[model samples]
Target: MANRTTRIDPAMIDRLADMAYLDRNPAAVRKRVEGMEHLLERLFVIPGINRPVGLDVILDLIPVVGGTVGAALGAWMAWEARNVGMSKFQMTRMMGNVGLDFLLGLIPFVGAVPDFFFRSNTRNLRIIRKHLDKHHPSTVVIEQ
Candidate 1:
């Protein structure tokens, strides 16, 4: 019987490192933010909408714990952004969207309606992506 060598791909290793450190170190942060940015735009950025709504809007439709669940989702995503080397300013902007969604969500039916349209996660994701672009300016950033 021949034994096969188990090898981890460098990209996987880098991804793990990136996640572990939350992209705090500049290079790692920049790379991970690229992902967050792409995800946000894809999920939320509607053509001609000017402002894209986010997934939290969907969450708000649920009964009692919906808003909390939505906020947690946004927070987890944002938490990764924090690790990915986002500046305090950028992080603040990201958190602001989540905060808005959470607060608006607390209201009754009216709030739920808006939540569907707000798309906070997508907005914050863009903020992270833009920051990375502004600071990092990589030539390879064209969307695949």
Candidate 2:
């Protein structure tokens, strides 16, 4: 029997570390929140009205548990905001948006309508981006 020694790449280790603790970096947090916001609010555009739609609307279309799931996702953004040292007032406003969206989404049949309009995740992402741009200027990326 022959024993083979495998070599591990240092770059791969660094990448793994980076992925493991992405939330610790302001830039990574910003990117993470932005991706989530995109998923929740603007995954695709509707053909006729040219409106962007995403998972928040789709999830809200489900019965009872849908609103709860959507709210939980929004709350996760709030958690990420806290990790970046957002002010309590900002947090309150963010949560309020989430809470309102959740309540509106609780309505039967029409729940998705409010989700389409309100977009709590996008609102929360805006709050996070504003904070990051102010406090961590280097993390700011110019949008083309």
Candidate 3:
């Protein structure tokens, strides 16, 4: 097979750069962080339920499929971090958090508690916020 070089459109590149810029805007970053927190709440916290169980932990009670689904959702946060220009080190650390959460969460009964507290999505969101704060200070929201 011959080597095929992929051609990228300049306009598309410009559009993506524009999107990255917008993503680093304070308002947009705040919205993204809020969305991540909401997702974390739904997955890790059950409303009015006395237990520490969330949908992800509850889902893990199923079998292999449950863990896979939870991991996929956790990975979404890392993807978002990448989109906003997180460093390779930060991205790797985020992946590690997700991986650790997924692995430990596989332990039948004992896994649930750890999964509830590990909160990889929340961790990844923090990493994204820190990256934005340092590299894209304009994106950091300041509340008086």
Candidate 4:
């Protein structure tokens, strides 16, 4: 076989750097957490009733594993919040929201029902947004 040269893709490296930035930067972290919250709490709206629904509710519908998965995702949001220098009191409140969501979600068929109203992910997102807006005012993005 002839000698071949392997070139590293600059675009791929940029993407990787962007992903890493999301974890450490306040602005990037805000977008990352907002995206997750949207996915978990408001991915779409149900027809007729016009109510929104998301993966959180769908996951809760499954037996034990679903709640665990949802809780894990919520915990991850809290972790990201900490990475942005969020206060301990705020983190505790965020975790409490996740914990309560997980506990309510453990109730088999009925568990999913609470998710529609509880919206823990949305609640947590609000906390993160408030913190970011107050401390990192430059990172704030005005919602249209």
Question: What's the TM-score of each model vs. the native?
Answer: 0.60, 0.85, 0.67, 0.86
Ranking by TM-score: 4, 2, 3, 1
lDDT of each: 0.67, 0.91, 0.72, 0.94
Worst 10 residues of 3 by lDDT: 37-46
lDDT of 1: 0.67
Instruction: Name the best candidate (by TM-score).
Output: 4
Residues 1-144, model 4: lDDT tens digits: 999999999999999998887779998898889999999999999999999999999999998999999999999999999999998999999999999999999999799998899999999999999999899999988779
| lDDT agreement of model 4 with the native | 0.94
The count of backbone overlaps in candidate 1 is 8
Model 2: per-residue Cα lDDT over 30-98, one tens digit each: 988898998889999999999999988998998769889989999999998998899999999999999
Number of the candidate with higher lDDT, 1 or 4: 4
* Sequence-dependent TM-score of model 4: 0.86
Which of the two candidates, 1 or 2, achieves a greater lDDT against the reference?
2
Q: Candidate 2 — which pairs collide?
A: none
Model 3 segments beyond 4 Å from truth? 1-30, 42-54, 142-144
Can you give the lDDT of residue 34 in candidate 4?
A: 92
Question: How far does residue 17 in candidate 2 sit from its true spot (Å)?
Answer: 6.4
